[model samples]
Target chain A: MTRPTRPQSAPAEAATSATPVLELRGIRKSFGSNVVLDGIDLAVQAGEVVVLVGPSGCGKSTLLRCAIGLEQIDGGEVLLDGSVVSGAQRDQQARTRMGMVFQSYDLFPNMTVLDNVTLAPTLVRNADKAQAEERARALLARVGLAEKADAWPNTLSGGQQQRVAICRALAMDPEVLLLDEVTAALDPEMVHEVLQVVLELADEGLTMLIVTHEMSFARAIADRVVMLDGGVVVEEGGPDFFEHPQTERARAFLRTFEFHRVGR
Target chain B: MGAEFLFQGATIQRLLAGLGVTLRISLISVALSVPLGVVMGVLFTRKNRVLRAVLRVYLDFIRVMPQLVLLFLVFFGSASSLGLNFSGEVASIIVFTAWGAAELGDLVRAALEAIPQSQYDGAFALGLTSKQTFARVILPQALRSLLPPSVNLVTRIIKTTSLCMLIGVVEVVRVGQQIIDFNRFDYPMGALWTYATLALLYFVICWPLSLLSRWLEKRSSR
Candidate 1:
């Protein structure tokens, strides 16, 4: 099976000089007797977009959660700009540097869209309310949601909610954005709108680590693609890795998506 | 003659005074219980096993024992055994506040638990502190689900204040009984009229609360 050729960013070769913006070194995590991640290492450089792709339950989402300090790792360490930000050292202040978006948009239902976006900036950064709202409005306008400033979250469509969620995370001015299946909960028609917002963010050179099942999207946006199976990295490469996966597990995983890609 | 006795100016004043006492106990208990119940409810959601266990015992004890028994224990037993003298009205207040707080605490716990975990995750992801998350995010949403049932609790407390009569507190029911005994010889149907007035008074107070609860339930569900 062959994938359609598309414009792709050059690999993150330019970022090898300084410490990575986000790094997970020999990380291990388990729930009860079940080991979800085992000694995995990954790095996302400043302005790099890394997409983690694997079969369900392969720890892709868990790894993203660990990077943002939402989940405590059982072994190894997570680092942000060469400083440790995991385990006992993980604090709310350190976590603000990394933004995360969940599968469920999870917008605070009680607040309006503008409030949702400005909450972290005003509360955590101590930014002026006017400054925070101005930035939030600009972010919302960028996503074509400026009119929804006073709208409650439940009043918006799934795609619009996800877009507002992206704005909320971006408003924090995070050093690295961690997206855990952000498009997973949207309807088929809605997924494109949400993904389009993300694609634009990629073009603006936001550093991101995304876990997604959208192979075509992964190929289009990822500077690096890391394939995982059974909690370990099986193959890591550039966009062309989809056509030339170096491992049997990665090959098999990519093959499963071919059935969906046949007529397209 | 029975109707005339029931509507006498002095008898009407006595009934009003008795109702005032009932409202004072019920409203005071509710005011104290709602806030204390909210704190206990939040504690119930925490992961502290010892704290949870202790609260659980308090909640369960209140649930299993009757409020009348609690009133008696406080009013009768405290004066003799604990050597702490409390008036009947004071005893009734203490017992009802304890009962209301426990019942309302359970209601609050259910409301808090009904909120999805994703709400907390969303708040924490934005770097809001735990206290901020509770005050700003969790409490506002919980209050929506909490209001209807809480209004229902208010009505229950108001009705149950009638039980204070058993503890020698002259609430509305006690006032009605006194009127009946005094007019027994002069008015043949005085007992019936006085009891009917007492029932009407309770219905007037509680009916509006039930309506408010239902209205709130409808709004929150939306």
Candidate 2:
């Protein structure tokens, strides 16, 4: 058996000085009396693929949502290219630069796949209709869904709907893409098709922040793996972090997943 | 004996003229109420407590009172107390429009609420402004859910127009009663045939609306 190797990019050490494409600084959020994210800091430099892995209720999804201004943060701020994009400064224009795909693949049921993908670009960016449709077609074709464009969202399989969702996000030409457990709702068989698309995006050097429960896929795709536990970063390292977790908490978390050595 | 009076002395023409009045009342009221109801519905969804409280009071006031009471208030009370002289037709329109707007407003609110929260999040995540989300995403979907109920409301409005004759509007039912009284002895079965024809007329108008509502329900569910 063989496993595909991750495409290498610029070394993380050299990319430190450059402004991150998306940044979360000392982010704090709570629901009612319960705190979900507590003063957490993380960044994804241009073209970096950062994967967030944590147990249920650990706030990985909340962090991704806050980064895109979906959930209002109680404290701290989010930044895009070093400019504050959170709190009062957050606006539609600022949010447009970040794309997000959810687990449920929230495609507008009222629209065809092409319409779903073209909607944001034409509405938000004021892009010309003909040109936006052309770009949308190209994005859909790239995701192996060119033929499905005329079909209503409900007509497609779950995996296909998710692929169209990715196409919808990419249509915005976002500076950073956010994936929130994109495959959590998929059947075991359909997960691969969605993961494959994300891997291709990674190879194309698209900057992304991903939260996933699939340990093997996380290890395969992450340039930097950040393990979150109890609303804080418990460990952060390269893919080698999986081989030798630095903290007991990280080690204990990894043990929960049955390890399958890739490329052994 | 059966429907013999229906052919006597411009009876058919008189009934149709009265029906035309009923339809005019219904049409004008529907046009006024639907747009007003839609606007009220959108406002109802907002988180403003004071606005909702005021609108709730208006909705409850209209709901608790009978349509007959409303018609009397607008037609007789206004003329006597407020010194605002409105014809019976005008009063009927005012009362029915108020009633339709309130009922439709609630239906619109329920339809809007039926939309999952994720749809709003999805639209927002795509960078659509709040207005854009409502116009392009939220409203189009809400309209689908509300269509069947709205059609049903239209039928209700048309049927309820029969009540306007009580206030001396002399609509279809009123015309039927006049025909039945004028031939009571000569045409012994006049009342039965006259009332039956009135029922048939109502059925003719509302039956298609009911069918349309059912059709819309089926399509939306699919």
Candidate 3:
């Protein structure tokens, strides 16, 4: 492991809870004849960046969706911040405390970027409009697009839209943010810019679970890597797993995707 | 050409008075229908199976039954059976309003359902509650979808108001029939022109709404 030249920052306030920010136990889901998340188990500590990487149709997104209660688990439990999020003990409000960003950057096309970012805060958090706009502006600046606040989302580039979507997720002040293949939809040239913002968030010690195909992003940002295939965790480890994956499936999966050259 | 058929005092006065009644019924019925239609339309898309089944049955009954039959049932059949004593004009408004509400409700529901589920998913992921998400995200977006069908329903309601004549409400068409009743010997063209004027008035009332619907449809496509 490459050692940090400076002292690592303290974990975010969101991570200080006794319970893991998110925990899933034996999650199983299927679409009729097709089984998706088959008895998958994962836990994410507060302020930890957990990356779930696998080939398409491996149920990586489904697992993240299940974690957030966007999809009902056919079997098993999802717990967030020590409280159950789904099943007999599930509280819908607890699930709301976690935010999710989609690969498609599903910004409300009818709204301005500022409105899109501030929506949940104003509506659900009951923040006054002025405060919401102020926070939206700050988050927009963090994503390097302060001037794009009043612009419609359709007017922005793919990378810009994705970044705005990230800002939107952050606007909720969620304890955990789930990113499902956030950069996969960006152009090759634009992927780094979007990933750079995510890396910055990771550096700030935000607790995040990102499902990704971007191998280098998986390596540089994730404190822990969770590899999934055929609705199961094929392997789980640290950054080095990218270079020397243990499972045959993980090895084969990584071999198919070309990773960008790093540390030149 | 008989001088009696000419646009003199009484005939013109009667036409204007009939036009007023026609406009009043159309406006009031639409006012009642639009909001009712929107509510019914939204309710149709809800997940409650019992409500859905009930609404479906109600919508089917309304759709399959002829409007004229419904009008007679409400104004003539039910009014007499229930011993209510409203004048024909007031009964006409109530019957037409009910008809309009059911139609509009169906349109609202279709517009709500046509919206992609991903839109709701995207909003839910943002931490907005289902109610907030629907009110903020779904409803505004669905408005464009609702417009065209709503305009169509408005035109249908306007045309259907002619059925009021059977119940003895002296709307424009009824007045035209009265003129034909008196002047059938001298000039048949007087009634034809009167009916043509009524058709033109209906077109004037409805054409702008049709244009609005088209414009909304075009905008949403973008």
Query: Which candidate should be chosen as best, given lDDT against the real structure?
Result: 2
Model 3 chain B: ten consecutive residues of lowest lDDT? B1-10
Which residue pairs in model 3 clash with each other?
B37-B104, B37-B105, B41-B105, B41-B109
Model 2 in CAPRI terms: which quality?
high
Error of 3 at A201 (Å): 1.9
**Where does the lowest 10-residue lDDT sum fall in candidate 1 chain B?**
B1-10
Give a tens-digit lDDT track for model 2, residues A1-264.
112554457648746678888889999999998889998999898888899988899999999988888889988889999999896647888989999999999999888999999999999999999999999999999999899989999999999999999999999989999999999999998899999999989888889999999988888888899988888999999988889999999988988887668898
Q: Residue B164 of candidate 3: its Cα lDDT?
A: 89
Model 2 has an lDDT value of 0.91
How high is the TM-score of chain B in model 1? 0.97
**lDDT tens per residue, model 3, B158-210:** 77888888988999789878877787777757667667766777788778878
Give the candidates in order of TM-score, highest first.
2, 1, 3
Task: Assess each model's interface with DockQ, reporting 2 decimals per model.
Answer: 0.80, 0.82, 0.50
**lDDT by residue for model 1 (A91-156), tens:** 889889999999999999888999999998888889999999999999999999999999999989
Over B123-156, each residue of candidate 2 has an lDDT whose tens digit, in order, gives 9889999889989888989999899999999999
lDDT of 1 by residue, B90-162 (tens): 9998988999999889989999999999898888888988888888889999999999989998998899889
Model 2 misplaced regions, further than 4 Å? A1-8, A259-264
Clashing pairs in 2: none
